[model samples]
Every structure is written in structure tokens, then in C-alpha cells.
Target: MAAPAATAAPSVPPSLSLPPSQFARIQPHAYLLAHLSPPSASNQPSIRANGRAPSQFRVTSANAGSLTHTNGSAVVRIGDTAAVCGVRAELLHTEDIASWSVSQASSSNKRRRLADLGEKPTEEDEDEDPEDDRAHIEDLNLLVPNISLSTGCAPGFIPGAAPSALAQSLSHQILSLLHSTRLVRADDLRVWYQQPNLGPEEPERHNENEQMDVDAEQSATIEDKPREIKAFWVLHIDIMIISLAGNPFDAAWAAVLAALRDTKLPKAWWDVDNETIVCSDSVSDARKLSLRGLPVASSFGVFEADAAAGWRANVIPDATEQTQTGKKGSPERWILADPDGYEEGLIQERACIVVDKQKDGKTTIVKMEKNGGWTVDTEDLRQLVEISAQRWDEMKRILDQC
Candidate 1:
């Protein structure tokens, strides 16, 4: 008789059953890209979701001054992404800031300086101390920005915990961008306070506290009037991401622009007697903040021919020929501007381009960020900028309408 048939091995059931397609099972993002990618014509994506052109952005909507408490506020929506920005202005006494710097320098920084070199500061160093006075403490930190990304905005964010690294980095980036661009007028924030002359006996008053950035020759000819910035307007800008589909930077930038444009600061007067600044409560006394330029941000998702087509296509195009060692070559990428969440996940290259149209009609690039490992040529960047300019115009038109 035949040897007892080998006992059949038991089969273990699969823990999960994935989609039938190989890419769908192994890489869901690739499957999504392959199935949902826009139709191609001439090796380019021809159309996007919802019948949009490849370069077209999703519908944008903005509403200004949405919050009552804030000096200015706005809600901006870019497709499924939503962000709310609020601006609040406060008066900061220049003297107080100088004093704090001086105190801190004297107490802590001075100790560090002494400890580092094992010697006291030299006379020249003392004379050149940056914390000595208001002029030396040129703190251009008038605008403070914070970004909030709670669990409600996205699934990964934990509730009740401090903002994630992503949020903090975004916040710092926004602040740096605002400062580098000089979007707000510096002169507008300056306001002076001076005591009245007693019985018109005070000589031409000249003091360091009453100094201005006037030229030496210009100061000699000017009349006796306080031009010093005793107090300044510090704008506290808060941006909250309520919903995120993709492209947080673009949505946040739009919201910030709208809110800042709508900003109105209450008339503040420095009280010589009280040594404080008094802000007017009347809405009629509120003045609109000066805006230098409006910068619009455009985000793009880069999709390579290999990834975009995935397993669905018969042949995948590579940017460069493969080497004899069988190593993969560079990939040819197509940019999808204002990509939704699904498209963003599959993309390896992302770019955020900011453009501002000056009053004289010249368009300037405020900032451009290209992230991820994919390589983009100058021609592609030029094309991207052209699209960004067009999108900026579109965003401006929408803002103007609202």
C-alpha cells in the first residue's frame, strides 16, 4: 500500500484581505494615484478631480472680520482645507522693553559674558552694549504668530497636548515670512509721548527718549516736537486650522492675508501723566492698518509618471535611462497644484510658491519651498511660477469680490 498520504498541512487564514490589484494591496496611495489621476494628453495630466484643469485650484472662499473680539479676523477655505486667522493689536511701551532687556542683560547675559572669558567686559564693549537703550534694542519682533492644529483638524494631532512640531515650525515660518517681506508699515507702529512745557519756559527739548531716526542735518532744521516711538503696536496673529484636506500653508497664508487686510487698530494715545497708552474704544476711532503688499501662496504636488500610472499602465517613463547596474533612473514628474489629501499622500515632491503683485504691477516672488527627494529642472520651476502667478491673480480676484 502507498505510504500513508502525507498529512495535509493546515492553512492559516489571512488576517486581512486587500484589494485584488497588486498596487492596491501593497501601496494604497499608488492605487489611488493610478485610478484617480487626471487623463493624460501629450504626456501631461489633462484634467483633475471635479472637472478641474491640472493647474486649476479648488474653489476658494474668504470672509473678512469674522470675529467680534479680534481687531481683525477672517475665515478662508480652499477646497476642504479651512483656516481662521485673527489679529489683535496691543500697545507695547518701548521704554519698558528697553528696561527689560537691560535688566536681563545685566543679570544673566552679563554673567555669561564674564564667565566665558574669565574677565570683565572692556570699555569699548560696555559702550557698545546692545541692551543699553531703545535705539540699541532694535527688536523687530512686533508681529507674533501662533498656529493651532488640534485633533479636530486632523486625526494625528493629540487633544490637550502642546502643539506638535509641525504646528510650531509652521508658526515660526509664517512669522519669519511676514518679517522678511515687511508686509506691515514700520512707521505706522511708532507713536510718541511727551510732557507738556510748563509756562512755556522749557528750552528746545532734546533727550534720548525723544529721539527719532532723523538725519543729523534734518534734526537741526526740524521744529521742537516729540518724534520718538514711546509706544508701538504689537500685532498678535493667531491662525487655527479647523479642517485639513491638504496644503495647510496655502490655506493659512490666504487666511492671514485676508485677516491682515481687514485689520483696524484702535486709536492709541500715550498719556504723559499716567505714563501709559490709552486705546480708544469707539469703532469710529479705529484706523485701518497699512498693508505693504498682498502675498499669495500656491502649493503643488509632484507626481511621477511611474507613480501616477502605477501598475495600471503597461509602460512607465523615466527621466533618464537606467544604468547597466539596474539602478533606477530619475523620474519625470508632473505638478498638481492645490492637490487634495489623497493626491498629496502619493506625491514625493511638494512645492509652496508665494508671489506678490506690487502696486506698480511688477510681480515678486516672496518665497518658494521645494521639498522631498524629486528633482525639478529650471524649466519646470519656471512653469510652476507662471502657474503660481496665475493662481495668485485668481486668489486676489476672489478676495476682492468678498
Candidate 2:
């Protein structure tokens, strides 16, 4: 006669509305719309009682080097959502299309000068195809939002499928954003293919007595060339939703920045004489991508009823209590920052706004998408830009800690 186990409380049936299948289509968004909004300050978690607000974000943690084989890797956990990013690099030759770019010209001149200075043409170069002797160019690829939905996160999987469509879309969005922005460069990460045709009596071979002079001359030529500019690097980022708390866009952006901060690219060697490629394995020789600064996201909830009144919306960096409460929730709607899962179900309408600030102090709204029913006016858009710019510098400083 075993005692009966205590029964758990009955839970609400999972709603079929807005299923994962549909989410996959929109997850790549720059700003994920979160519908969760506290009915009032009193309805939020205890943290709000401790002076925290309903829109406040949870502690975000970042770590790197989880995977050793990848060129570079990093992980960021914002509350329950966790994302990992890995960087891999490959060396490629300059395409025939852009054979005369600045990189090609500079590398070509260096190699020719090296040959003239009497350094023995390495054996590798001796075996190179005469046609392949032309200058080399390199390109970079970055893969992101490789979604891995851990069992610990949710039971929203579509049986017999890999990642949901939402996951793929998110990954693609991040990769596209990173690539179009030129945040990394592949040309600089080239690893020379060490040509194998240099003969002992090659024209560039230096006599023993002239070895020191040749070395000096080659060094001088290399010194004359300006360092290569790396527009962006290829990276693979895997984002796992450990908790579907809501606002995937903001969490993803934070994760992307964290992954990039720790990502490293291999060092490259150029066959300056032949405008060729060379990659290095030594960490000391590798380079890092120069990010344009953090691009944070904000979202607004427009009530379906507010369509007639014209729902006002803007993206701001540092919002004050006055600004936040400038408009109250009507039967129509409201805009909020970083909404969580529960609030989404409660709201009738929503929209997301994202901003990226250039080094010159100009802010660009890279993304805007909304659901439910509301339209924004120019005056509201202008206010959002001002708010985003004001907070850009400060947000960057905090995000730099990652």
C-alpha cells in the first residue's frame, strides 16, 4: 500500500495561437515584438517592487572559448536565452573580376620588390602555375542564428524536424546584417599558399654575400605598404533559446555583440610579388574584426483600437519616467521596451524598432515591423532617433564589457 503522490496543480492548456511554425518566419527581425505588458507597475515581478521597472532587462552574461576547434567562439546568456557564435576562416585568391584593387596592387608590388631584393624564391613559389601567379583576393562569410532549441527551453518542437523555420530566419537575418555592414574582412585573413616553384638559381635568389642587404631592402619595401583594411570576417553563430521569455530580437542582438567581441581571425601572409594569399595559425599573428559599435533594439505595443488615433512610436536609448508615461494604455494600445512572453499574449498590437549608430554620430533605423493595428507619424519617428542617439554612446560603453 504505497501512499498516493501529491498531484500538481492543473495548468492552463497551451494555446495554439501564434505557433512556433509561424514564429520561424519572423524571427530574423532586427527587433522582436514582445506583447507582454504589465497591467500596471503593481502587476510586475517583485524586482519591480525593489525599484526595478516592468520593462527592465535581466542580468546578461557572456563567455568565450566554449569550442576550441573554431577559429573564434563566444557565448552570451541574457537571462534564460543563450547564444553561441563561432568563427572559421579560409584563404581564397583574388577573383579575376577585381584583379586591380588596392589590396591586389599593394601585394603585387611587395612580391616584385622581394624578388628584386635577392631573397631566394621559396620552393613553393617555384611550383606555382604561371597563370595563378596573378594577385589573389579574399572573401568572408558569416553564418548566424543557427538555432538549436534545447529541450530545457521549451516543448515547441515540430516532430521529425531539425530547427524550426523561425530559427533559420533569425540566423539569416543576423548574417545578412553583419555582412551588409562590412564588420569583418577576409582579405586580411588570407594564408599564403606558399608557392613551390622557386628554383635555386631563380632570378630573385640572393648571393650569400648580399643576403643581409637583400633582407634589409625587403623589409623596407614591406614597411612602405599600408596595412590591409578588413571589412568583415566570416563567423558562425548558434543561438539557443533556453527560455522563450520573449523579445528574441533584443536577446539575439546582445548575443551577436558578445560573440563578435571574442571572435578572432587568423593572421594572413601575402605573396606580395605575385599578389597571392597566405594564412597563419599562430594566435599572435591573427587579427580581430572592428565592430561598428552596438546596435540595441526597442519595441512598442500599439493597441488595435488605437488605429484611429494614430499610435505614436519611437526608439529611444535613455527613456525617462515622464517619456514612458507620456501616453497611457488605451483600449487601443501602448509601446514598451523589451517585452517578455506573458505580456505578448496580453497585448492586442505590437511593433519593433531597431537602431544602429554610426561613428559619425548619425543613427540609422535599420528595422521596423509591427503587428495588430497602428501607424506612426514623422514627429514620432524623429523623437525616436533623438532618444536612440543620446543613449548610443553610453549603451556601447556598457556592452563593451562583453
Candidate 3:
């Protein structure tokens, strides 16, 4: 079957309407200049005024507490591109009372039986009350690009349809990166309960090591002690891509850091063994999430476009400049660092670098993804590492302020 004829552009009020040409003309400065500049000045003054090379970064700014409704909220802006993230916290509760009531009854009965046997209920019970906190965390969803393309960057987007598939992929990359690095700890939100009164007949203390002889007639069974304290904090990160001026990864990272800065975990009472959760309102009752060091990711583009030859290879940085220089004129493509979107349009190879910093003033590249287009010599890789180490402390300072 033949494809349906394209429909005419929808007519709307002049003030609210924009032409396709107008939208297309609003491309990134890097893109526009790359094509418009004279060959003599093609690469001159192309980077931002902040002293960043075309491949370098601008002065990234991040701020927290932009929203009152959320537990935490932050805005991260890199040049003109901006991303806002808000964290909303809600306690987990049973949908029906029957299930909860039954569980409570079973626990109470077990305690009663232990009391009757002249055994004291252990302090272990104090911890079980917060088990539900972890469940609350797992149920949370981090909505990225939540506002979608309605902001006008993506014209003619279908209603109810998500931002394009590419947007989803990028968002997932940001979300998964945050999760795997343990940037947000789930156990810091626990709130303890009021002390329960013990009956007069109960023993003052019971030796935990001493086991009671099992009797068929007895009504109490001791549960195995929990090995790990359950996580009590539930961080619900909502990332809204306010504007996509390119460089979504950096924008996402800055947003996540900012969101965490103002984040306050709600106090919760928990039981690990029983997996129960109770929300607490007092600030004194809550604990802060421990922040591991910031693990930042950088991507470089390796573009090799020979329009005359009718050949174009768009690739990310798979090797450093030193390596490519060593094999000067080698058709084998390789890039040291990931460039912005415009650079990607002309790249033939690429690489991804993830740097991890230690508390002892040491730094190392924990992860590297390299492609075969080019190779990075050890010396140039060392230079990149040195640059990262020098910049990491500054980055952490910026993150801490958020």
C-alpha cells in the first residue's frame, strides 16, 4: 500500500504558531557556526566565553530547594541547557488493613508466648519495625524527561507519546549510573518507635546465646536474627528536562547532585525481619544519607568527516590525542574525549571515561569504554587523568554547595 499523503501543517493563532524553518534555525551555536564560519576562522572563539575549549565545559551552576512541595529539588544549568530534579518522599502502607492486622497479631502473640515462658522479648524487635522502609524505596520511580518535548524543542510530538526513543535511552543511562554508584543510600531514613512497656513478670534480661530447650507443648519459636539492617530512606528522584540544548549527560549529573543536596530523608520506624515501615515527622528522628564520593562520567567524540570524499564517520572518543598523534595520518580513527552533539556529527571514533576519587586525595579511572577507531597513548591518558584529578576537588566543592 502507498503511504498516506502528508497532512498540511495545522493552522493556529499567529502568536502561538511557529514555522518549521524558524524551529530548524534555532540550532546550537556550535552547529550553526561550524557550517557558517569562514575556513580561516572556522575554529576560532567557538567555545563558550568561560574559557572552555570547543570540547571543554562551561562553568556549571547547580542550586537546590527550587520547589517547596518536594522533599528535595535542584536546578542544574550548563550554559543555556537546564535540568531540574525533585525528590518526593512518601511512606509505604498496606493497601488493606487485614493483611497488616494479621501480621501484627502474629507478632503480638509470639511476644506474649515468650513472656509466658519467662523470656524477655529481645531488642531485635526494635529493628523489625523499619523493614518496610526498603520496600518504600523499591517502589519509587525516577521520572526523567518528565515534562517531555512539550517545551518546544521537539516539534510535532504526539500527545501521550514519550519524548523520542533516544531521550528514553539517555535518561536510562543517567538513572542507572546514579543507582549503580550508590549515590543515594536507602538506610538513612529510619525513625525508631516509642518504647513498648514490658510486663512485671518478664525477666530483666535473657542470655541471647543460651537456647531454650524445644518442647512440643511450648508455644514460642525464636526467629533467626536479621543479618543486615534494612535501608530506611526512599529517594524518589524526578528529573525534568526543561531544555535540551544538547549534553544531556552533564545536565543530568548536575541535576542529580543538586537534588541530593537539599534532600531530607523522612524519619521512619522499621522492622527488618517483619518488613514493616512507619513514617515519622520529626527531623531529629531522621538520619542523613551517607554520600559516597562523586563518580563523574565524561564522553569524547572522534569526528572524521570528508565531505569531498563523500565519507563521514561519527564516533565517540576511543583514544587520546597522544595516541592518534603517534600514528599520525593513520586512517584508523580514535578520539580522546566525548564531544558535544555537534562534534558527534563529524566524529569517527569515541571513548567514555568514568573517574573515581578516593577520600585520601587519590584519583583513578575506574572504568573506560574504548572503540577501535583510534588509540590513546599512555602519556595522553595520564594527562587526562591529571586533568580529572585536579578538577575533581572543584567538582566536589560545587556538589557540596548544592
Candidate 4:
């Protein structure tokens, strides 16, 4: 009876303890905000939940020629987001294109008129006519890019499912950028054939005059027949999301850029005997694509401090209190670079800047897209562009090494 009287109940701690992972899972917004806006007295630099500075980007690594079967292939990883891209070149004969003849004739007539005017077309002229290049690629569908996100790469993406909206949107974005940048030149994709000039039969004459006349006729006949485009190399660009933590566009585009840079198209020619195009089997005869510029993409997210739960909200002074005290308050908003999945869910505003650095140390903005919120302004865009320039350099160096 005495032994059963007192097995003193073990004392329990006042509060329950939770692992960081569990805490993050339970209160994602508050967890991220706590890291981003630590106490002023803690003397800690503001960092993201992933332990990166507000403007810090994840480490990027790339590998080219990863797929031996494809004409060109690359694998790129930016932190947890990974993508693989493969480029396959297929021949599209002029006969297969219903409008090829019409387009070619129109272009030839235009060139002839220009020649008659004694105005030779220059590089600057082509630059001014950007739509010509765009039309060629878009009309012919020379560059076919498709993205797949049904590989169970991330949450909500079931395996073997239909292509999701994200996949469709990404594919469209890639296609638009390809047309706008004119990255791949049509001339490079064209395979030409010189038609044999059959001149009118001339009476046989045993005189030098007759021989000269024959030569003149041959020259005229040859001049009349120009090299014709027999076929074009249609590039099929396929991208697969291996792992998608967040910021998919950047990773996907980087993979495509790397794969295109590593891509080597076989030297092809129109075989007169076979009456078809033939490609050289030797690797030495292959050639790389002449990409126009090294355009790189950088993504960002805007996190509002007030978006977190009230239990863990930071102590932001009221506007009236600040005005009365005449003391400035810290900013309650933050711009995060390369946000991960957790941060992405809580962030409503986002921006992406595609930048290419020129040889003169100037940055050119290929594309600038922002949506979901209006907190980001022109000055913020300028700053983002600068960050994109740095990212461009980093991407260029990685691709060059690959």
C-alpha cells in the first residue's frame, strides 16, 4: 500500500519543443519572416529561411553533353531546382513546306528590286528588319521547344500526367524568347543545292567565235540559277524538370542555353545521286549553333513583413506614432532573390529580368516581367537589372567551362 501511494508524476516542461522542420511545416510564413527580420538587439544579419542573404542567389552548376543520343544535351541545377534539356535536329525538306516556294519567291523578288536600286543589303539593314528573321522561324516552326513537368519533380505534379499549365506557359515563354532574340540564324539551318544549268543547244562550229559564244551562253545560264534551299534543320528542343523547388523558368532556360551551346549539328548536304539530304557520320564535320547572344535570366520575390501570422509578427511602429515621434522606421518589405518553394508560396509579387552583357561592359535587358503586386518600382527594376548582370556573368562562366 505504501509503495503504491507515491510514484510521483514526473514533472513536464512548461512548453512543448518542435524541430525546425516541424516548425516550418506548421507555420511557414512566420518561420520565414522570423529569419528575414530577426530582432534588432540580436545583432544578426537578415537572412532567408534557407540561410541566404536577401540578395543572394543559390549556387549554380551545369554540365553539357550529358545525353549521348541527343544532338545536344545539358543538365543545369540552381540550388534544388534542376532541369535537363536536349536538342535534336531533324531535316525538313523544302517540298514538305507548303509555303516555302511562295516565301522564297517573294524574298528573291524583293532582293532583285533592291539590287536594281543599287542598294546592297548590309548587316545594319538586317538588324533593322528583325521581323524577317522572326517570321522565318515562326512561320516554318524551325525551333520546336516543349517542356514536361509530369515527372513527379515536385509536389502536385503526378507522374505520367498530362502536361500542366506551368509546362505550357514555360514552353510558350521559351518560344517567344527564341523568336524575339533570333538566337538561331535561318542561314545556318538552310541546306542549299545548286541546280545544274542546261543551256540551249548550239550548232557545232569549228571556230574560236563559236567557242566564245558558247562560253557566254553558259555563263548567262549559270547566272540565272541561284542556289536553292533544299532543306532546313528543324531543332526539337525538349526540356524535362528533374527537380523543381522553385524558380523553374531560370533553371529551364539555363539548361536550354547550355544544351544549345553544346549542340553540334552534323554536316549535311543534298546528295545529287540519292536526291535527298545526307549527313556526315564523322564528329569532326559537325558544327555548333551560332547563338546570337548569351542572355541570362534572374528571378526575384517580394516578401511583406506584415504578411506573417500575428503571433510572430515584427514590432513595426504605426505611421501616426512615427510621425508624432519624428523617427524613421525600418522598411517592412524585402526583395528576395531566387526564392525557394516555401518563400514562393507566401510571396505574391515576383519579377524576372533577362539580361545580356555587351562587350562594352553594358547590360542589355532582353526581357523584364513582373506581376502579382505593385511594390516593385522602376528603381527596384534597375537594381534587379544590376543583379541580373552579375548572374549573367556567372552563367556565362559556367557555360564556357562546360
The lDDT, on a scale of 0 to 1, for candidate 1 is 0.73
> Judged by TM-score, which candidate is best?
4
Q: Tens digit of lDDT per residue, candidate 4, span 29-138?
A: 78888998899999999989898999999999999999999999999999999999999999999999999878888877877998899976764564346565676778
lDDT of 2 by residue, 1-402 (tens): 999999999999998667644663544121122322334655753232113343455556666666798766666665555666665554334353353376556656667887799864553553242322222211323243365655656567644667777677766766656555444433333333433433233246558657666666766665554344322333456666666666566567666666666667776556667665555668897667665556665655432332223224333332223234555333323344445554454455565566778768777876666666433445655655565555455456655665
Residue pair clashes in candidate 1: none
RMSD of each: 12.3, 12.9, 13.7, 4.8
How well does each candidate superpose onto the true structure, as a TM-score? 0.71, 0.55, 0.60, 0.88
lDDT score of residue 333 within candidate 3:
29
**Candidate 1 Cα misplacement greater than 4 A, ranges:** 1-27, 35-45, 49-51, 99-140, 194-226, 307-330
Q: Which lDDT value does model 4 have at 306? A: 67
lDDT of 3 at 322: 32
CA shift at 311, candidate 2, in angstroms? 17
Candidate 1 vs candidate 4, lDDT winner = 4
Against the hidden true structure, what lDDT does model 3 obtain? 0.55
Better of 1 and 2 by TM-score: 1
Kindly give the stretch of ten consecutive residues in candidate 2 with the minimal lDDT sum. 129-138
lDDT of 3 by residue, 1-402 (tens): 999999998997668655544643454433433432326645554332223453455466788889999888888877566788887765534432235456455566776798799986556453333343323333343222232333554343556775687567766776666655655544454334433333233334456332232232122322332223322334567777676655566677667766776777766666645767755778777545565567776666543323211122233243344344655453332232435444444544556566878768678675666564543556546666665565566667777776
TM-score of 3: 0.60
> What lDDT would each prediction earn against the true structure?
0.73, 0.52, 0.55, 0.85
RMSD of 4: 4.8
Residue 97 CA displacement from its true place in model 3, Å: 16
lDDT of 4 at 380: 87
Which scores better on lDDT, 2 or 4? Answer: 4
